[model samples]
Target: MKLASYADGSRDGHLVVVSRDLTQAHYATGIATRLQQVLDDWGFLAPQLEDLAVQLNHGKLRHAFAFEPEKCVAPLPRAYGWAVVDVEGSVRREAGQFQGPHQPLRAPAACEPALAVITGDLAAASDAAAALDALRLLTLAVDWRLDGDLIATHCAPLAVTPDELGEAWGGGRLQARLVALHNGAKLDPRDVAAVPGDALARLARLRALRAGQLAGVSLGALELPLAPGDSLRLDLKSADGQHSLFGAIDLDLAPPPALP
Candidate 1:
């Protein structure tokens, strides 16, 4: 199994898992379960994590899972919650084809890890509270390769929802486009709602947001199976509109060098 994991910044940062062997589709679920084990150990929604595995690339035998940050939060009291992450898995194939659809971050040069999240059942308050305790100590958790005799463990925390979302974007090769603004340009709520065309409307909303004239700014991206963290901000008026996007990756939870 040639697993290259990365953060899909699209849907609040979902985890993306890919395999090189087209014949390995049967193992997709198994791989996803193993990843869930990681999340369970780290202290996210244990029961909820069981239901998150999904197939993203059935042809290439690739699978994906996502964790919703908004929904994965703890009930209360124990403010501990999932925030950061670092996933590391083995690369059974060449790096070129691993992230062929997914690109690596500019800074760290390493293979990405797979995505994992909870599905099936809605995470309950009780589960969320339990998860909160786990999320607190996640920063001190250690990563280990699936090695029988020689295990290579890295001292790092498990990847979070947003980080995994970045992986999903790169792994899926999905594109994003601007949608609409909610409350664009608030003229002290005294003036009329500045309603412009989709393009210009966004520009006005952004200005209002910058000038602190609006309560908040709302922008949407087009695509399905959003990973949570997938986002790109473009300076519509800047000299041709320079754009900048932020995402995350998982390189700490790398599988062992040897494969089964």
Candidate 2:
């Protein structure tokens, strides 16, 4: 099941179910209005959303519409927390700094690709296996840093349920390449060396990692310089190089404001 958030002026946008190929979508209107609501009640709400996804994918829904990435926000526009472990094994948890689609920002210094997981409520000390079981959705991420500090993190337009990856998701890791495109050219294909387990295991030590909280493991090393007016597209391709798993993080950074 693939899910997204359509911009609705509110902090949490309207929930949407996207097709596997990511070309179409159906509003999860009656099922749920926000992604966080579904995450809060996954056991009851997720299956319904899954059914809608099936209908949307098969063109059985009459109200399905074109999936527009430009009109998207972060999957969880207001997540409980955003915890990320960088290549240096440093873990940082902060209020979510997320963007989607064409949202522009100040010029970013460097862009690094990553894979993120949205996990359900997890108790402290939960091992990697347990952490894996709590995983809800998976998506691609781009870490845009300035002066070695995380300036922004762009999440792919759509997030898919872990099972959506099929064989690509195994051993608590997503066997995929975090592909970053600069101006339509491949800048770096970050074969995520920091697997989900690496981040999950580190996060497990925390007192509690609640639902609606996102965690990620960045690509081990490498940063692609992104200049002002640069366009960056971040997505995940199957390890075997078959297809795109998540939608994409298509961002364009605006040039810095002129001096007064």
Candidate 3:
């Protein structure tokens, strides 16, 4: 079931169950008022939320109203931890071939794109599930600063989840894409590189996750620079155009302080 947390004049906001088509919603306050609370007790709350979803779809719930994405924040605004697995070059490495320069590559590789754990509180993560049962799901929109330069900034919305996100990596590669926009102008499209066969299996091998921790797998490898007044928008769509995930974040040298 699709779920979202909306701004309700509170830090955690109000949790709601969104319809499949993204048109309508029903307040899930009866089950949980915050998204993190529901995820913390997913075993017990999922079933209850599922039942409510059925009722809402059948026109049986009261106060069901139109749902807008703009009014919603990241599903989990403040998670315990957010880590990204870089699957972009997994395929090429497995075949004993390097896609970049043939020169002797240095150690501590320049752009190996290893698993990166984001620091700070500016990363916004969103979900894109295939069958809704997948444990490893979600995409990310991160605010970044240029290396060694604190003033230059950029926001990258990368790693959209493909429809195969829930499927096992059975000697097959999943296709994905990332489309980025800067100040309303479209940038070049980045085709997601193939994920190696063993990546997913390794991820599954890890111990079960705790309540508030989140793991993300990014699909595309496009990077662009942004200016102070510029805005960035990213959209990741499934190969069949059925499922899509989106994120938007602004860039600034230093954001203004929050109001008291």
Lowest lDDT block of 10, candidate 1: 209-218
Top candidate when judged by lDDT against the true structure: 2
Candidate 2 per-residue C-alpha lDDT over 72-172 given as tens digits, one digit per residue, 9 for 90 to 100: 99888677888878878888776776877567857766766667888899989888888888889888776677777878777878888878888788766
Question: 37-154, model 3: which lDDT tens digit per residue?
Answer: 7666667886798788778778787799997666665555566654444554222111111111111111211111221111111112212221123342244333222352222111
Which window of 10 residues has the lowest lDDT sum in candidate 3?
A: 93-102
Compute each candidate's TM-score over C-alphas. 0.16, 0.92, 0.61
Provide the lDDT at 89 for model 1. 15
lDDT of 3 at 68: 67
lDDT of each: 0.21, 0.80, 0.45
